[model samples]
Target: MPVEPDCIVVGGGLAGLACARELACRGRSVRLLEAAAASGGRVATDTVDGFRIDRGFQVYLDAYPEGRRQLDLDALKLGRFEPGALVAEGRRLRRVTDPWRRPLAAVRSLVDGTVGLGDALRVARLRGELLGRMEAGGIDPDRPVAADERTTRAALEARGFSTRFIARFFEPFFGGVFLERGLDTAETVFEFTFAMFALGSACLPAGGMAAIPRQLASGLPADVVEVGTPVAAVEPVATVERGAVRLADGQRRACRAVVVATDRRAAERLLPPGSLPATDAGVTRGDKGARMVAFAAERSPIGGPTLLVSADRAGPIDNLTVPSDVVAGYAPAGAALIYASVRPDWAGDDAAAAADVLRQARGWFGSHVEQWRPLATLRIGHALPDESPAARRWRPTGPRLAPGLFICGDHVTSGSINGALVGGHRAAAAVDAELASG
Candidate 1:
């Protein structure tokens, strides 16, 4: 508290922590301030009755090129969910597995017409194309997913995929990934994510998603990162009166430079109008948020480490999973845990939505759903940056807000853990350059 650092990082999420750490490594004094009781922003976990419930359903993808540079996968000890999902039909569920991984289940799905052979083949074809594009730097996040502005549906149709395939599979599967249906997000996001899956398995750390940021922070000095330290404002140009950060308690902390790494709304609130170079363009704020309800079950309902996709898409529930199936110690003695999610924007009122979800889930597991107990609900208001055509076309202009001010977050880049880490390092590089020039 007594030392005046060269850089002050606001919002102790992955981006901010990464920025602070990088600046410290460069031999510049650094201080990271987090408003919340803990870091990780949206990447948080809750321990309820011995079960760890993550904030919404999030996966630590090992394939994120940027994240791989920042984290050691082997040290995290990740657990994987099966390659494919169980698509839900009228009232029953059909198991669809990756042909390359689970040949028998893929063949069975083809035989049962659960997933048309043409569609299955198309999925495989797209996988190859994306992986190739990613390796060759053709589908970089810097490059828009689509060549021009168009709906994801249009892109899929142009690629020759049928409407049935898009409605049934892409909606629940990727929609769950994007958290919005009708391909409202950029097709490029879908493409990059697909390539990621093709390249690496979807995984969770042995501890939980929170371990991600904790690991990043653990390497830094203890006093450098401060949790529960809310920042109320930032000075545009450092002055004797206004130094680096204006604390919520009316105290000012002076620093040679300041990097604000917070969400869209917080960034808008903290900085002066039009100070954010990356967000000044058509960056979109998602109107929808993902609601995750964790349940304690008597046993595994789906019976495997696979996500159950809702083909109907009419019900409140989008998909369900048993975390216990993916990793051990998720439940108490002789019990299991189930994670259910719904797009609340589609689902009706709160009571109606919960009722509809439980009822529809009953359709899948029969009366056994009644035995499941509702435990926790995590609602992430700003889950994703709306990747519209204009938004997708966005590229970083520079990383300077003023002589010594900077900004970084998912909003500044691709909108993922990878984007955050990449953006953080980018900000650090800018800070290093400016400080050196001085």
Candidate 2:
């Protein structure tokens, strides 16, 4: 008879893969099960007609501490975006570059009224403050909510940013990031994200976001992670001091411990009832949804890799970018790949959303927009966990749920690539300690 594995990791997403890698490194045998035909969970990509389309608009911040430690950055062949954004102001686009990075562009922004001198000074001060925080032990994923902590919008207002600046710049820029336009995400998350952008570049891997999970799984043994295997439930065998995971197909796999590294909803379903408290089980009131529509164009709209954010609230499109401008491989030879992010409210009807996006694109890119062919429309319901103040108040749940059952995911930490990796590492350490004590 074959020997059972030391641990079985449920969900082969980044968190699960990271957990399995850590366990294997500690000399424990691990088996990871994933329901999809491939891993990566929400961070997936599809190739259609020579255009690479990520499930939703996503980026890899090179400054993520866990990412720096876990991933081989150079191996992914990252394509970087310019340090600032192009704001759509009225009938024209205004270039806004980081003053610290590009003084010439910053001066031009001031001259063109993209940002007032006062706001420009405030930006410098904000950048310095965030960078200082990063240097001073970095942002803690599990930090308690400070008494003065407020919503992103409130925080910006407290920092003395004008209402016009908030709406013209911060709203559309971060609206796409948090998948919500209310700017209700926690202030800590906003600070952390700002620090990351200040410290490093926001990039896309040559092979799309899927390259991240693929690189993580590459270090593990071939038989360790099994895609297309859905885990039905996790049952603890107290008498034997072990656990068994039942698969959707009725097969049972026994292991010393089990790690539920799925998303918030899936994790709640797989674990036993009452295993998690109401706070942890319902940490996020609801998941944030997002939509992205990609079109194949013969020429680039912006002619560069900088992001274009719409300041107009009347339009459905929030932001636009040409992936091919950053990485040639994203589109076939001589073709440009345009990705337009639609407002969450507009994501319901694909046909309507695409039509509205095209209408708006025509305003920005002129009549040439008519020649752009639609490539794909991706509507992601669970694009990110809620990061509102109420949700963030609850600290991340500990990894251990029972003697042999544990859980880890982005929901258990802050919502980001770094948070998922941190959760995985923490869970692996907890499991290793429990097994060692026994």
Candidate 3:
């Protein structure tokens, strides 16, 4: 029989790995299992032709409060994008600065003859109203709390945001992130992400996007890791004598408790009928977006200033960033890396879709594009757990479904990287508490 450890963590992404690390740190023997050849999940990166390319444009806002406390960021060298944004609207490039530093930029933007003062003022007023609602507890921070269910475009139009501002800013900027336009998403997501933006701008790691999980994995005590050992099934009601996990390769390991930290879809397969809250929880993907496309060039196309282009209010391509300037090692000397991402319709063609996006990009950067070349691409689906209205309702109270079973993942309230860490810590603490009570 294979040696049974104190705990068995069923995934190796940020949440699973964090659970394993936390358990090990507490002197509990742990067996961390990963389905992929390596760890990190969507946190992907690649290097080729002497340039580094992340799976997508992953910028860590300095304001993500949880990121600061959980991960030892110093160990992973980081970088940042420029402060302001260059918006491409109707034959002219408009600049939008951070509301704090460039109060003038906002004022000037109102008068720049783009959206006109009336539309701009309407947007500002709507923003204030949304913030006010949030402060009043009208918005639920934990769930998909939309003031109403309408397309983002309809919501903005209802609030009096002009077509120009929607096309220039919302479609290209937030659209790229959420993978939608017409902004029909739940209002709560907009509030959360917008709050993050206001807290601080985006940032990148010097090495690559992989550096984050890589760093987290590195800190774990070596004695606990188990690579290439895929967990076949988890029997939450198993006897301590029989062990908690039943492996596919005819292996059995016993543990005091278990953390099911796989993705929501996969977790649904592994968990019992009543284990999860609902296959679809609070948020639903009303629409989908295209895969992310990254490229490392002999030189970066992004100039000293970051350029963002939105073709129209419902534009597909949202924003663009050049990370080489922020991080020294992203490209070879005197060269830089450019990351471009777009949101294609659910049934959009891949190559054709990419080409259409590229055409739009050429309109802005033109000849400067010669030096840059294509890199890796990534598409994240159901990033937030699929929580649709029709799904049944069920919420697990504590770590154990039975006496020695537990679950953890972004699906559980803590969705972001920080949330994953917190979930892992909570699971471990729950196990500790149960053991103490015994």
Candidate 4:
């Protein structure tokens, strides 16, 4: 019989992969179990008729500290989007570029009334302030925000941003990021996100978002990461200092430590009833859902790789991007791929949702939008955890839940790719320390 592993990590997402990698690096024999056929939990990609469509419209910020530390970025050959976005105002599209990066375009925006002079100046000032704070280490997600910290909307208002500007720009731009148009996410998260965007490029790997997890998994031993292995529950061993994970197949595997790195819902079910706090207990609430509607086009609409956000409340689409424009590998030769994001509540079914999306796209791209072929409608029910101020209060739960049991995920840190990796690294450190002490 094969000897028992030192640790068994449940969940083959980024957190679980990172945890397993860190443990193996520390010279501990580790095994990672994933319930799905693939390693990436929420971060996945699918091939539809030669088009590489990610599970949703997602991007990776090069400046994410944890990502920089954990990922081999160069190998992924990332493709970057333009620094600014094209905002849909009525039938016309207004190009808004970052003043620091594209001064000439910023001037054009001011000339065309895309952004008022006052709001333009405030944007410059806010950029500098956020950069300075980031340099001073003011954007730590591990630390709790002050009780007086404001919401993203409140912070923008306090910073003298006009309500019109907030609704036209910040709402749709960041609303797509936080998955909420209210802009009620914590101000600290907003600050960190803004700083990262200002400091780095928003990019996609050549292979797609799934390439990230695949790269992480590639570094480990072939047998270390096991997909299609569903763990039923994590139970403590009565006669040993180790723990045992009961598999869905009724087999129990013993290990020195067990780390639950699944999503909030799965983690809650596998962990003991009282292990998590009351605020993090329920997963049905305090989660965000989104859908990605992909359409194949004969040619590019916007031309360049710029994200487009809908400022008009008259449309159901929040944002749209041509992935093939950013990365040619996203689609076949001579073809283009467009992805439009909408709230899960947009329509009753995929057909209705796709029709509504095309109706809105026609307004932005003219009648030619009707010619675009519908590819896929991907819906993510729990795309991200709640970033609201109330939800932020319960964020950053620790990794060590007991002597032989631990937990990690975006919920244990901030909600992002960086947060998941940070949680995994922290859990590995805690597990290493505990095992070494004994």
Candidate 5:
């Protein structure tokens, strides 16, 4: 192939893949450049002795409107978690389920005071409202819909949930999702997430989260995506008023269109001279980082693929998940996968952190935790974007920086697979429009 092409897509995560795939489908010659050894970015999985461990605890909510449009859920062969979660309150674990799906669990939840009868009734009303909102494009397709402008903590309080429920449930549960314990994440995000939970199951691809991007890449032409190739900068492509992707190794490939589908830092560097997209909050503030340390047990301790949330919030451990429960092929024969999100404060020293986490795991899973072997300690620096009120509301107007330069990725939209796919589509559409106009 020549050093020049119609378009060049940088970064091999969801957004890059989306841009490349869409451009190709539009009959434009495209080249996808990825710095990593493989695609998927944060949506990656690592295998240890036959057990597939996701980069961190992640799930695919079938309710994401963009995801439903961009992916073939049936082809992914997804495995789902049960409707609700097991909230650990002191020594007892309370079953919290959607009353619409599990009537007995709902009754038990009310009886156990996990949620008061009035609060339960109010939550049901809230669910009905969310359902109606979802019917209008999965609720808040562009911005927050709630009339209240307070934080999640304040909103829950004003809504009349018991103080005990707030401490034991909302704090720890939303903390895992936002990576922030106080629920300071924009109320818009909280409302969107709550609506998603009511709409569908929290699931994973049978192979792993990595399977998501791999599947996306699989549908494209084999030669389109080039992994292990790091792009140093995006410059002019000769005298054609286009792009030249300068690789770290000093090689340059010219193309008519260039999409920098990487992170914010990279986007800033790659954008044409004097082009900036207002420096969005998700770019400046950055998202929270998570440290995950998992343990492999001879037998599953949590019983089935149930997720156990630490209502007490006693230690660095916040939640526990058994991935192999839903996807039997995830673990080696007879071995079960157990993982937890250890607070970043505890991740100062690996050996010390692993020992500390193990000591606390025993309290939750009994003496059996002692027998669970340490699997891996993984830290994702930019796991999810800082979803502040401004960040969630931000979306790209178009993919062009100059006539031929463009940008996309989670940073360009919301910080999720949904956000990335949307970004990709936006870039592709822009490129198609620009080429046709010229």
Candidate 6:
């Protein structure tokens, strides 16, 4: 007899897991299907030779409202990064004071010679402009506005910031966050991210970045999760007999509803012909955002794991983090691990890139880095989620071509952990509503 689940949630990433947890909590017999051996998808951690290496660099931005309301942080053992950023420009290193800290740090940052009077004034002016925009209803938090053309560079330069200030700080900092530092990313994104930086500190989970999804999965009943199960496709039929999902293992599962919470490209493959409507907003299918490599060092770097953005304009390595300081158990005694990313534009020969990274590190840290051993260079495709301001209204609301099939994941909402969680919650609610309507 083919097994039939009341609800089948496809994809075991955070979004899928979140949806499964919600449904299972509601007492529904839900089955979570994961194509991978384990869950966590992009947010995974690996235990290397006596050390922990996160697949990539990811941090919580201000405890997003969706995650704060839905996720159980206690279960995850979340930890925060250091308060302020230690920036490297030329041979000189400086600390960028965090606004949440004392007023003196903010004042010192302004008066400091490192940023120069002009740059300091620009920073203050930009800060005021952002505050004013937020206050005057000039920026709508929900609606995606067309005038949001502020990229990190444009914003900084608009305030008369110097090239040195941008290259050494904003470029690296925003590059680490937005992948393409030169990208004309939406201004709203820059604003929201700046707000997050101001309001919250960079944080990681004790076990690893994977702890986030693991914690969400912990909320689900063990019997409900079915790993290594690939959902072949979802097809919509007639009323009452509506939709069906076929698994790759030659098993057909009947479901009253389905949540396709995998990657957009993967989700599209599972849908029946013409099921998805033609619209500008669909699951993004292309090269994953960028590739990153993670290494475990025997000692901490110059900044002690404070996130560093390489000041080099053409450099391949975008961001750097010392895991030892960000989270306690990231490194064993007397050792540290650092995760570095090679932007998609920066990908090529791994060996050559690694060499370049070491060379660049030597200059940025003011120390020799050639001695550091090379570890796994995790080729993380689809790293960043699509965070364009225009795609805010693309959340899945109606049924997929397959009668009971639905979709979730970063593509559904803007591709952050919070977006994934919110999408999952929305999928669960939609299922509940559908069940009630019937």
RMSD of 5: 2.8
Identify the superior model by lDDT, candidate 2 or candidate 6: 2
- Local distance difference test scores for all models: 0.80, 0.86, 0.64, 0.87, 0.78, 0.70
lDDT of 5 by residue, 1-438 (tens): 345778889998999998888888898888999999998777999999889999999888888888898899998898888877887655567777889888898898888777888878878887897788778765553433233456777778878887877777777777777777777677656777888888888888988899999988997887898899999888853445666888999998888888889987677776555565465444446668888888898988777766777765556777778888877778988989888877644445666667877777776667888888888988788787766654544444556777788888876666667778988888899988988887
Backbone clashes in model 4, listed as residue pairs: none
Give a tens-digit lDDT track for model 1, residues 275-295.
854544445555457887788
C-alpha TM-score for every candidate = 0.93, 0.95, 0.83, 0.96, 0.91, 0.86
Residue-level lDDT of model 4, residues 339-381, one tens digit each, is 9998544555766888888888888889779779999998888
| Model 3's TM-score against the true structure | 0.83
Question: Tens digit of lDDT per residue, candidate 6, span 155-176?
Answer: 6677677887777667677766
Better of 1 and 6 by lDDT: 1
Residue-by-residue lDDT tens digits, candidate 2, 1-438:
136888899998899999999998998888999999998888888999999999998889999989999899999999999988998866678888888888999999899888998898898999998888778976675455665568999999999999999998898888778888889988888988888888888899999889999999998988898999999988855545578899999998898899999998898888887666666565557899888899999999889999998887667888899989887689999999999999765534887888888887788789989989998988888988888888766544588888988888888887888888888888899999988897
Cα error of candidate 2 at position 125, Å: 1.6
Tell me how candidate 5 scores on lDDT: 0.78
Candidate 1 Cα lDDT to native: 0.80
lDDT of predicted model 2? 0.86
Q: Is candidate 1 or candidate 6 better by TM-score?
A: 1
Stretches off by above 4 angstroms in model 1 are 142-149, 238-243, 277-284, 394-396
Question: Which portions of model 4 show Cα errors greater than 4 Å?
Answer: 236-240, 280-284, 344-348
Worst 10 residues of 1 by lDDT: 277-286
Highest lDDT: give the candidate number: 4
Query: Once superposed on the true structure, which residue ranges of model 6 sit more than 4 Å away at CA?
Result: 1-3, 116-168, 237-240, 277-287, 303-305, 366-370, 389-403
Output the better candidate (5/6) by lDDT: 5
- RMSD of every candidate to native, in Å, equals 2.5, 2.0, 4.1, 1.9, 2.8, 3.7
